[model samples]
Target: MRTAATLGPRRRPVALMSFVAAATAMVFGVAGCGSSDPAPGADLSPAATTAAEVVTVRDPWVKAADKGMTAAFGTLVNSSRADVTVVSASTSVSPMELHEMTMKDGKMVMQPKAGGIVIKANSEHVLQPGGDHLMLMNVASPVKAGDELTFTLTFADGKSVQFSAIAKPFTGAGESYDPGHPSMSPGMSMSPST
Candidate 1:
Protein backbone atom coordinates (compact mmCIF):
# COMPACT_ATOMS: atom_id res chain seq x y z
CA MET A 1 0.00 0.00 0.00
CA ARG A 2 3.02 2.31 0.40
CA THR A 3 3.12 3.51 -3.20
CA ALA A 4 5.75 6.01 -4.28
CA ALA A 5 3.09 8.67 -4.96
CA THR A 6 1.71 8.24 -1.41
CA LEU A 7 5.16 8.41 0.22
CA GLY A 8 5.84 11.25 2.64
CA PRO A 9 7.94 14.19 1.43
CA ARG A 10 10.85 13.11 3.68
CA ARG A 11 10.75 9.52 2.25
CA ARG A 12 10.21 10.50 -1.44
CA PRO A 13 13.95 11.01 -2.11
CA VAL A 14 14.81 7.64 -0.56
CA ALA A 15 12.16 5.91 -2.68
CA LEU A 16 13.44 7.60 -5.87
CA MET A 17 17.05 6.64 -5.02
CA SER A 18 16.04 2.99 -4.51
CA PHE A 19 14.20 2.97 -7.84
CA VAL A 20 17.19 4.45 -9.67
CA ALA A 21 19.61 1.98 -8.06
CA ALA A 22 17.41 -1.00 -9.01
CA ALA A 23 17.15 0.26 -12.60
CA THR A 24 20.91 0.64 -12.85
CA ALA A 25 21.51 -2.85 -11.45
CA MET A 26 19.07 -4.35 -13.95
CA VAL A 27 20.71 -2.55 -16.86
CA PHE A 28 24.23 -3.62 -15.83
CA GLY A 29 23.08 -7.24 -15.23
CA VAL A 30 21.66 -7.42 -18.75
CA ALA A 31 24.83 -5.97 -20.21
CA GLY A 32 26.99 -8.45 -18.26
CA CYS A 33 25.05 -11.37 -19.79
CA GLY A 34 26.03 -10.17 -23.27
CA SER A 35 29.76 -9.75 -22.53
CA SER A 36 32.52 -11.01 -24.82
CA ASP A 37 33.40 -13.99 -22.66
CA PRO A 38 33.09 -17.23 -24.54
CA ALA A 39 30.25 -19.61 -23.76
CA PRO A 40 30.72 -22.99 -22.16
CA GLY A 41 32.60 -25.50 -24.37
CA ALA A 42 33.71 -22.71 -26.67
CA ASP A 43 37.31 -22.85 -27.81
CA LEU A 44 39.25 -19.66 -27.22
CA SER A 45 42.80 -20.92 -27.20
CA PRO A 46 45.48 -19.95 -29.70
CA ALA A 47 45.05 -23.34 -31.41
CA ALA A 48 41.32 -22.79 -31.77
CA THR A 49 39.36 -22.14 -35.02
CA THR A 50 40.48 -20.26 -38.15
CA ALA A 51 43.02 -21.46 -40.66
CA ALA A 52 45.73 -19.08 -39.49
CA GLU A 53 45.39 -20.13 -35.89
CA VAL A 54 45.11 -23.85 -36.45
CA VAL A 55 47.89 -24.17 -38.99
CA THR A 56 51.56 -23.81 -38.04
CA VAL A 57 55.00 -24.52 -39.46
CA ARG A 58 57.44 -26.61 -37.48
CA ASP A 59 61.23 -26.65 -37.87
CA PRO A 60 61.15 -24.35 -40.84
CA TRP A 61 64.41 -23.82 -42.73
CA VAL A 62 65.43 -22.53 -46.13
CA LYS A 63 68.31 -23.72 -48.34
CA ALA A 64 71.10 -21.15 -48.43
CA ALA A 65 71.86 -19.75 -51.84
CA ASP A 66 73.69 -16.76 -53.26
CA LYS A 67 71.09 -16.15 -55.95
CA GLY A 68 68.77 -17.80 -58.46
CA MET A 69 66.50 -20.49 -56.98
CA THR A 70 66.28 -22.31 -53.66
CA ALA A 71 63.83 -24.28 -51.58
CA ALA A 72 62.39 -24.16 -48.09
CA PHE A 73 61.62 -27.14 -45.93
CA GLY A 74 59.29 -27.49 -42.99
CA THR A 75 56.51 -29.52 -41.49
CA LEU A 76 53.10 -28.05 -42.01
CA VAL A 77 50.94 -28.99 -39.08
CA ASN A 78 47.16 -28.66 -39.11
CA SER A 79 45.39 -28.75 -35.79
CA SER A 80 41.93 -27.92 -36.96
CA ARG A 81 39.02 -30.23 -37.61
CA ALA A 82 39.17 -29.48 -41.34
CA ASP A 83 41.92 -29.68 -43.93
CA VAL A 84 43.87 -26.65 -45.17
CA THR A 85 45.33 -26.35 -48.66
CA VAL A 86 48.23 -24.02 -49.36
CA VAL A 87 47.71 -22.60 -52.82
CA SER A 88 50.67 -20.25 -53.12
CA ALA A 89 53.58 -18.73 -51.31
CA SER A 90 55.56 -15.49 -51.42
CA THR A 91 58.35 -13.60 -49.75
CA SER A 92 60.21 -10.35 -50.03
CA VAL A 93 63.25 -12.32 -51.16
CA SER A 94 61.61 -14.08 -54.11
CA PRO A 95 58.49 -15.48 -55.72
CA MET A 96 57.63 -18.89 -54.35
CA GLU A 97 55.76 -21.95 -55.59
CA LEU A 98 54.55 -25.11 -53.97
CA HIS A 99 56.53 -27.90 -55.55
CA GLU A 100 56.59 -31.68 -55.35
CA MET A 101 59.03 -34.34 -56.54
CA THR A 102 57.64 -37.15 -58.69
CA MET A 103 59.14 -39.97 -60.77
CA LYS A 104 59.18 -39.01 -64.43
CA ASP A 105 60.94 -41.08 -67.13
CA GLY A 106 62.85 -42.95 -64.42
CA LYS A 107 64.05 -39.63 -63.03
CA MET A 108 62.89 -37.79 -59.98
CA VAL A 109 61.59 -34.47 -61.22
CA MET A 110 60.36 -31.47 -59.30
CA GLN A 111 57.44 -29.55 -60.64
CA PRO A 112 54.83 -27.08 -59.60
CA LYS A 113 52.42 -29.02 -57.47
CA ALA A 114 49.01 -29.16 -59.07
CA GLY A 115 46.15 -28.09 -56.79
CA GLY A 116 48.64 -27.05 -54.12
CA ILE A 117 49.60 -28.95 -50.96
CA VAL A 118 46.93 -30.12 -48.57
CA ILE A 119 47.58 -30.37 -44.86
CA LYS A 120 45.02 -32.75 -43.45
CA ALA A 121 43.28 -32.06 -40.22
CA ASN A 122 45.14 -33.25 -37.16
CA SER A 123 48.06 -34.27 -39.33
CA GLU A 124 51.33 -32.91 -40.68
CA HIS A 125 52.78 -32.50 -44.17
CA VAL A 126 56.55 -32.62 -44.34
CA LEU A 127 58.55 -30.49 -46.73
CA GLN A 128 62.02 -31.93 -47.07
CA PRO A 129 64.87 -32.19 -49.55
CA GLY A 130 63.92 -34.37 -52.53
CA GLY A 131 60.27 -34.16 -51.51
CA ASP A 132 57.48 -31.62 -51.29
CA HIS A 133 58.92 -28.15 -50.68
CA LEU A 134 58.49 -24.44 -51.27
CA MET A 135 60.58 -23.29 -54.20
CA LEU A 136 61.84 -19.72 -54.16
CA MET A 137 62.58 -18.68 -57.74
CA ASN A 138 64.74 -15.77 -58.92
CA VAL A 139 65.99 -14.71 -55.56
CA ALA A 140 67.14 -11.10 -55.71
CA SER A 141 69.57 -11.30 -52.81
CA PRO A 142 71.77 -13.89 -51.26
CA VAL A 143 70.16 -16.12 -48.66
CA LYS A 144 73.12 -16.53 -46.37
CA ALA A 145 73.46 -19.01 -43.59
CA GLY A 146 71.67 -17.90 -40.39
CA ASP A 147 69.56 -15.45 -42.32
CA GLU A 148 65.89 -15.36 -41.44
CA LEU A 149 63.39 -15.04 -44.24
CA THR A 150 59.73 -14.30 -43.78
CA PHE A 151 57.18 -16.01 -45.96
CA THR A 152 53.44 -15.83 -46.45
CA LEU A 153 51.45 -18.88 -47.41
CA THR A 154 48.07 -18.22 -48.95
CA PHE A 155 45.44 -20.87 -48.50
CA ALA A 156 42.71 -21.97 -50.89
CA ASP A 157 40.15 -20.35 -48.62
CA GLY A 158 41.82 -16.94 -48.98
CA LYS A 159 43.25 -17.19 -45.51
CA SER A 160 46.99 -16.76 -45.10
CA VAL A 161 49.65 -17.54 -42.51
CA GLN A 162 53.01 -15.84 -42.12
CA PHE A 163 56.14 -17.53 -40.82
CA SER A 164 59.87 -17.11 -40.76
CA ALA A 165 62.49 -19.70 -41.62
CA ILE A 166 66.22 -19.67 -41.09
CA ALA A 167 68.58 -20.26 -43.96
CA LYS A 168 71.10 -23.11 -43.77
CA PRO A 169 73.78 -24.44 -46.10
CA PHE A 170 72.47 -27.54 -47.87
CA THR A 171 74.26 -28.98 -50.90
CA GLY A 172 71.93 -31.93 -51.29
CA ALA A 173 69.23 -32.23 -53.97
CA GLY A 174 70.97 -30.58 -56.91
CA GLU A 175 68.05 -29.57 -59.08
CA SER A 176 68.35 -29.14 -62.86
CA TYR A 177 66.07 -27.95 -65.61
CA ASP A 178 63.74 -30.48 -67.17
CA PRO A 179 64.42 -30.52 -70.91
CA GLY A 180 61.35 -32.67 -71.58
CA HIS A 181 59.14 -29.97 -70.17
CA PRO A 182 59.97 -27.23 -72.62
CA SER A 183 57.23 -25.08 -71.16
CA MET A 184 59.45 -24.35 -68.17
CA SER A 185 61.82 -21.49 -68.77
CA PRO A 186 65.60 -22.03 -68.67
CA GLY A 187 65.78 -20.02 -65.48
CA MET A 188 63.68 -22.56 -63.67
CA SER A 189 64.93 -25.76 -62.10
CA MET A 190 62.55 -28.68 -62.62
CA SER A 191 64.45 -31.86 -61.89
CA PRO A 192 65.99 -33.00 -58.61
CA SER A 193 68.96 -35.28 -59.06
CA THR A 194 68.22 -38.53 -57.27
Candidate 2:
Protein backbone atom coordinates (compact mmCIF):
# COMPACT_ATOMS: atom_id res chain seq x y z
CA MET A 1 0.00 0.00 0.00
CA ARG A 2 1.34 3.48 -1.03
CA THR A 3 1.34 6.19 1.68
CA ALA A 4 0.38 9.82 0.84
CA ALA A 5 4.06 10.85 0.81
CA THR A 6 4.90 8.00 -1.56
CA LEU A 7 2.24 9.41 -4.01
CA GLY A 8 3.84 12.88 -3.93
CA PRO A 9 3.28 13.73 -7.65
CA ARG A 10 -0.39 12.77 -7.54
CA ARG A 11 -0.94 14.32 -4.11
CA ARG A 12 0.46 17.69 -5.24
CA PRO A 13 -2.44 18.25 -7.62
CA VAL A 14 -4.95 17.36 -4.92
CA ALA A 15 -3.34 19.80 -2.48
CA LEU A 16 -3.48 22.62 -5.03
CA MET A 17 -7.16 21.95 -5.75
CA SER A 18 -7.98 22.08 -2.04
CA PHE A 19 -6.17 25.42 -1.66
CA VAL A 20 -8.07 26.90 -4.64
CA ALA A 21 -11.36 25.74 -3.19
CA ALA A 22 -10.62 27.30 0.20
CA ALA A 23 -9.56 30.62 -1.31
CA THR A 24 -12.72 30.80 -3.48
CA ALA A 25 -14.87 30.18 -0.45
CA MET A 26 -13.24 32.97 1.54
CA VAL A 27 -13.59 35.48 -1.33
CA PHE A 28 -17.30 34.72 -1.80
CA GLY A 29 -17.93 34.79 1.95
CA VAL A 30 -16.62 38.35 2.38
CA ALA A 31 -18.37 39.64 -0.80
CA GLY A 32 -21.72 38.12 0.24
CA CYS A 33 -21.60 39.95 3.60
CA GLY A 34 -21.50 43.45 1.99
CA SER A 35 -24.15 42.56 -0.66
CA SER A 36 -26.78 41.48 1.89
CA ASP A 37 -29.91 43.64 2.20
CA PRO A 38 -30.38 45.79 5.33
CA ALA A 39 -32.11 44.15 8.27
CA PRO A 40 -35.72 45.08 8.99
CA GLY A 41 -36.35 48.52 10.63
CA ALA A 42 -32.85 49.72 10.05
CA ASP A 43 -32.35 53.53 10.21
CA LEU A 44 -31.41 54.80 6.69
CA SER A 45 -31.49 58.52 7.24
CA PRO A 46 -28.54 60.65 6.19
CA ALA A 47 -26.01 61.94 8.68
CA ALA A 48 -26.63 65.25 10.42
CA THR A 49 -24.68 68.33 9.33
CA THR A 50 -22.83 70.65 11.69
CA ALA A 51 -22.21 74.37 11.27
CA ALA A 52 -18.59 75.20 10.61
CA GLU A 53 -16.76 78.53 10.53
CA VAL A 54 -16.07 79.53 6.99
CA VAL A 55 -14.43 82.91 7.57
CA THR A 56 -10.75 83.16 8.38
CA VAL A 57 -8.61 86.18 9.27
CA ARG A 58 -4.96 86.02 8.31
CA ASP A 59 -1.94 88.09 9.45
CA PRO A 60 -3.99 90.68 11.33
CA TRP A 61 -1.95 93.59 12.62
CA VAL A 62 -2.59 97.17 13.70
CA LYS A 63 -0.40 100.10 12.70
CA ALA A 64 0.86 102.00 15.71
CA ALA A 65 0.37 105.75 15.68
CA ASP A 66 1.17 108.57 18.08
CA LYS A 67 -2.20 110.17 17.55
CA GLY A 68 -5.59 108.73 18.49
CA MET A 69 -6.13 107.18 15.06
CA THR A 70 -4.63 104.10 13.41
CA ALA A 71 -5.52 101.30 11.04
CA ALA A 72 -5.56 97.53 10.88
CA PHE A 73 -4.55 95.40 7.93
CA GLY A 74 -5.05 91.75 7.10
CA THR A 75 -6.35 89.29 4.59
CA LEU A 76 -9.89 88.06 4.99
CA VAL A 77 -10.52 84.71 3.38
CA ASN A 78 -13.97 83.20 2.86
CA SER A 79 -14.00 79.45 2.48
CA SER A 80 -17.77 78.97 2.32
CA ARG A 81 -19.72 78.41 -0.86
CA ALA A 82 -21.84 81.51 -0.42
CA ASP A 83 -20.89 85.17 -0.74
CA VAL A 84 -20.27 87.10 2.49
CA THR A 85 -19.99 90.80 3.21
CA VAL A 86 -18.20 92.24 6.19
CA VAL A 87 -20.74 94.66 7.58
CA SER A 88 -18.94 96.32 10.45
CA ALA A 89 -16.08 96.18 12.90
CA SER A 90 -15.87 96.95 16.61
CA THR A 91 -13.15 97.34 19.17
CA SER A 92 -12.71 98.69 22.68
CA VAL A 93 -10.18 101.32 21.69
CA SER A 94 -12.52 103.21 19.38
CA PRO A 95 -15.16 102.93 16.69
CA MET A 96 -13.96 100.94 13.68
CA GLU A 97 -14.96 101.40 10.10
CA LEU A 98 -14.18 99.58 6.90
CA HIS A 99 -12.48 102.00 4.50
CA GLU A 100 -11.67 101.90 0.82
CA MET A 101 -9.47 104.17 -1.32
CA THR A 102 -10.48 105.55 -4.68
CA MET A 103 -9.13 108.22 -7.01
CA LYS A 104 -11.26 111.33 -6.88
CA ASP A 105 -10.22 113.63 -9.75
CA GLY A 106 -6.42 113.49 -9.46
CA LYS A 107 -5.93 112.64 -5.79
CA MET A 108 -6.72 109.55 -3.73
CA VAL A 109 -9.74 109.68 -1.45
CA MET A 110 -10.19 107.22 1.40
CA GLN A 111 -13.68 106.78 2.75
CA PRO A 112 -15.99 104.16 4.20
CA LYS A 113 -16.40 101.14 2.00
CA ALA A 114 -19.80 101.08 0.35
CA GLY A 115 -21.93 98.01 1.16
CA GLY A 116 -19.02 96.73 3.24
CA ILE A 117 -16.33 94.52 1.79
CA VAL A 118 -17.72 91.60 -0.16
CA ILE A 119 -15.76 88.39 0.04
CA LYS A 120 -16.87 85.92 -2.56
CA ALA A 121 -16.92 82.18 -2.06
CA ASN A 122 -13.45 80.68 -1.87
CA SER A 123 -11.89 84.08 -2.37
CA GLU A 124 -9.75 86.50 -0.40
CA HIS A 125 -10.39 90.15 0.55
CA VAL A 126 -7.17 91.96 1.27
CA LEU A 127 -7.26 94.84 3.74
CA GLN A 128 -3.96 96.61 3.48
CA PRO A 129 -2.61 100.10 4.06
CA GLY A 130 -3.53 102.88 1.57
CA GLY A 131 -6.09 100.65 -0.10
CA ASP A 132 -8.76 98.83 1.84
CA HIS A 133 -8.32 98.87 5.61
CA LEU A 134 -9.90 99.07 9.06
CA MET A 135 -9.92 102.61 10.40
CA LEU A 136 -9.84 103.10 14.16
CA MET A 137 -11.05 106.61 14.82
CA ASN A 138 -11.44 108.50 18.08
CA VAL A 139 -9.22 106.07 19.90
CA ALA A 140 -9.13 106.68 23.60
CA SER A 141 -5.33 106.54 23.75
CA PRO A 142 -2.35 106.41 21.46
CA VAL A 143 -1.41 102.88 20.35
CA LYS A 144 2.17 101.87 21.02
CA ALA A 145 4.19 99.15 19.40
CA GLY A 146 3.74 95.65 20.88
CA ASP A 147 0.27 96.50 22.12
CA GLU A 148 -2.54 94.07 21.37
CA LEU A 149 -6.06 95.01 20.38
CA THR A 150 -9.15 92.85 20.06
CA PHE A 151 -11.53 93.40 17.18
CA THR A 152 -14.80 91.81 16.15
CA LEU A 153 -15.83 91.56 12.52
CA THR A 154 -19.51 91.18 11.78
CA PHE A 155 -20.78 89.65 8.59
CA ALA A 156 -24.02 89.87 6.69
CA ASP A 157 -25.12 86.40 7.77
CA GLY A 158 -25.22 87.46 11.44
CA LYS A 159 -21.97 85.64 12.02
CA SER A 160 -19.11 87.38 13.78
CA VAL A 161 -15.44 86.49 14.08
CA GLN A 162 -13.28 87.94 16.81
CA PHE A 163 -9.54 88.32 16.34
CA SER A 164 -6.61 90.07 17.97
CA ALA A 165 -4.33 92.49 16.15
CA ILE A 166 -0.94 93.49 17.42
CA ALA A 167 0.16 97.08 17.17
CA LYS A 168 3.36 97.56 15.20
CA PRO A 169 5.32 100.56 13.90
CA PHE A 170 5.15 99.94 10.18
CA THR A 171 7.31 102.35 8.13
CA GLY A 172 7.25 101.92 4.39
CA ALA A 173 7.25 104.70 1.81
CA GLY A 174 5.53 102.68 -0.93
CA GLU A 175 2.01 103.45 0.35
CA SER A 176 0.70 106.73 1.67
CA TYR A 177 -2.64 107.71 3.13
CA ASP A 178 -4.91 110.12 1.38
CA PRO A 179 -4.62 113.77 2.42
CA GLY A 180 -8.22 113.73 3.59
CA HIS A 181 -7.65 110.60 5.71
CA PRO A 182 -8.59 111.23 9.32
CA SER A 183 -5.17 110.13 10.48
CA MET A 184 -3.35 112.65 8.28
CA SER A 185 -2.58 115.89 10.05
CA PRO A 186 0.22 118.41 10.56
CA GLY A 187 1.31 117.05 13.95
CA MET A 188 0.15 113.49 13.41
CA SER A 189 2.82 110.83 12.81
CA MET A 190 2.40 107.58 10.87
CA SER A 191 5.21 105.19 11.78
CA PRO A 192 5.40 101.72 10.25
CA SER A 193 6.10 98.68 12.38
CA THR A 194 9.73 97.64 12.43
True-structure lDDT of candidate 1: 0.83
Residues 1-194 of candidate 2: C-alpha lDDT, one tens digit per residue: 98988877644587899999999999988887884656678645321111127778899999887766678989998876667788899999988788887877676556678899888777898988767888886578888999999999987767788999999887732433455555455665333321
- Per-candidate TM vs. native? 0.71, 0.64
lDDT of each: 0.83, 0.75
Per-residue CA lDDT of model 1 for 42-160, tens digit only, reads 97754356678788999999988887778899999998878888999999998878888888878777778889999998999999988899988778999999999999999887889
User: Lowest-lDDT window of 10 residues in candidate 1?
Assistant: 185-194
Residue pairs clashing in model 2 are 169-192, 169-193, 170-192, 170-193, 171-192
